[model samples]
Target: MSSVPQPPRWDVHRLPRARGRNFLVTGGNAGIGYFVAEQLAGTGATVVLGSRDRAKAEAAIGSIGSRVPGARVKHMPLDLADLDSLKASVDALGLDRLDAVVLNAGVALDRPPRRATGDGHELMFGTNHLGHFALTNHLAPLLTATPGSRIVTTGSFAAKSERLDLDDLQSTHDYRPKRAYARSKLAQMLFALELDRRLRAAGSTTLSVLVHPGGALDSLTPSRPPLHVRTTGERLSRLPLGLLVQGKDAAAWPAVQAVLDPSVHGGRMLSPRAFGLRGAPRIEPLWSHLADTTTAARLWTASRDLTGHDPTFTAPARSGGTEGPAAGPGEADASTG
Candidate 1:
């Protein structure tokens, strides 16, 4: 009798070569985003760091170059808080094709009297959820144009427990900073799932996948000189914490895997395996709250209204896919909240 064959296990250190691909990572200048960019750069693909600060982006690029010789990486200015500039920012990429874009940039306020974006929406909600929503709308054409392209939205474990109050999606009624931040992330996660549904309905090849970094701590992260440097003492002290959590570099695995893994499919979510807290990336069931299509549809309508962009996406005609027109915000399913 033939022996049973086992599936190959994913190895984070060994990524498939992507010599001709193009990838964009928003907020790739620091933290988990920086590590994601660096790891992607190792695959011999061109990586663009979408950042607001030129200086910081340059530092990140330099650090990646230092770590990975001949790394092809550059910067594109993106201010997610400024809704007006996102389209122009996308236009600036000037790429003929984009293989994947990691929507990882975000704003998290630890303590606040509460703040609003330039467009007057709550800061966290506007930048984290709405900003990516609008950016995806603008990039829809390019994404659909590229064969087998992906839009990877990096959500947060912090969102697991929160519920969306559709009446006040921006946290106008109740504004604790941490809770508001979690809500914003929850909105992003919901949007990813809904987008996947719409894309599948339209027969598009472009995929939208979701991921969350488990608990990541700066103290556990390795040093990337000129960008981030973890002192020896800090590493020694945080070593024990690594048993429960992980460093920012390790936290980046789920998003990276989503971008590169062939088996990953749209609408599926990847998270850490160790109690959703720390371990290698693995496919996980969507949380019950995330499965609420009603909430997602309503949030989609609100996002369209707030951003003035309808994200009804479709594949290019050449791809043997039909195009769909943008739906009116009020035209959301009657069954939706």
Candidate 2:
């Protein structure tokens, strides 16, 4: 007789108290990012909501404050599609230390016309991979200074079905929306793995983790003003398929777990247990190709070349290190929203 399936060992819904800690969540204005921010703040962590639109950011902060009493939230305008905007926002934050950063912003729609960013790179690749690449490198020093800091890169199950063409990282010649998005997600996974290895090699305490929130429905997440407004159709549709497709709150569990769980270590991956669609977050083997070390290194090199940002950690001086924020050739700017 087949044995009954055991429940998840760790409770994904119930999070540990995180008072006095601080976190930054990209794309925190809506969907999974907003829910992740809420969850963190609900447990007493100060959350900074990063969004391109100030109104949306303030609205999200308000929503979080109303829902989670005593929630401390700040707004930092960030446009992931624009490098200069991201740098400016980071500078404005004036952060000396950060406990964790959740890189959750990206273009997920697999539509036609093959959009491109103002920087001339493919939209999906630029926003999902290069943008986060530059931002993380820019904040590496602050992250290194904070004990037990984590950099969680959000990936997707689609990475398993996508192929990365290192030669054409921008997808200049062959551009398909769905494939481009998949390749970008795959690049994110590779970057997370490589970053963990590099951080460890540098003897830094900061951890880099990879995670994916499988198939979450927007209908289930809170409706923020202006954006994330769930239409009647969406709410009605979710009524029948709620069990099959989990809400954004549940989907964000793995990312929040990656950040708060002390047991999670660098170079580890987390995702939903039930075939990546729904269930509690759990450690699982990466898709065979995404675990390729050689490819990860190559992606790292290519990212540095393209984004002009390096994550390599150097020893700080006894007095004060001279290493400053990374400065590279300016890329065209565009609104993430």
Candidate 3:
């Protein structure tokens, strides 16, 4: 008889408590983000729901509170597609002591090429990579204050399918949705690994991890075709169908693990159990080929330069634009925001 297979041992619900810690979950209003925030708040952590919509953030906070009384969830406006908005939000609510940060707000802006976040970069790179890049850098002081702080950024299996185009990141020469998304994810890997190098070189112990959710419940999974095509595909996929992993909850698993897992080391990678696609979460090895020292260093330099930050490696970004405020009688600082 075929043995009953066991599932991966990780379940975010079974994770340890996060009491006394603070977290920021962007796009926390819905989908996997909702679960991530809910879980964090449920564990007694102070969570700030970052979103572009004030009303939506408020609703997310209410949802968290209703689900877990006195969950201590707060709302702040954060638009990943707009650096100005993120800068303002950081100034308004980004604290001096951040224990963890989740850079989850992303879009499949594969519809068309466009400038995003800030600095007139392409939409995919700007929103998926640069925006979070700025946010994390701006909040460096707060993160470092926590001593073993973790920075969690999302990656996708699409990296395997798409190659990097360093010369024209905006795809001015050759722009495809898949290529844009993959390059950004590749940047995510390079960014995380380089950060680890920088932290270790400076003798710092903070963890910067990258997690890919396989197929998860994310849009990365192509929707099935019509009934006839789907049926045939399903039958053919039987040899591998069981290995497919898909779902936001599943994707969130690896991310949650990377940040919360005590056993995880800096720069480590975690992914689903399926054949590079979807399932329960666990600590997997880094896609080691991504351990490109030259590439990592180069990407870091490019990112900092492109994002309007300085020192090519360390130091906070110089506020490039005129500062503004969220409401009456206040002005946001672009430098650290």
On lDDT, the leading prediction is 1
Give candidate 1 regions above 4 Å deviation: 1-7, 319-337
Give residue 234's error in model 1 in angstroms: 0.8
Ranking by lDDT: 1, 2, 3
Cα-based lDDT for every prediction: 0.88, 0.81, 0.67
Model 1 lDDT per residue over 1-337, tens place: 9989754566777777676678999999999999999998887778999999999999999999987878999999999999899999999999877889999999999997889999999999999999999999888888877767889999999999999999998888879999999999999999999999999999988899999999999999889987888999999988998999999998999998898777789999999999888999999999999999999999999999999998766756673664321221112122100
lDDT: which is higher, 2 or 3?
2
Query: Cα deviation in Å at residue 107, candidate 2?
Result: 1.5
Give the C-alpha miss distance for residue 297 in model 1, angstroms. 0.6
Provide TM-scores for the models.
Answer: 0.92, 0.87, 0.78
Error of 3 at 319 (Å): 32
Model 2 score (lDDT): 0.81
Clash pairs (backbone) in predicted model 3:
51-78, 215-277, 216-246, 216-247, 217-246, 217-247, 245-278
TM-score of candidate 1 to 2 decimals: 0.92
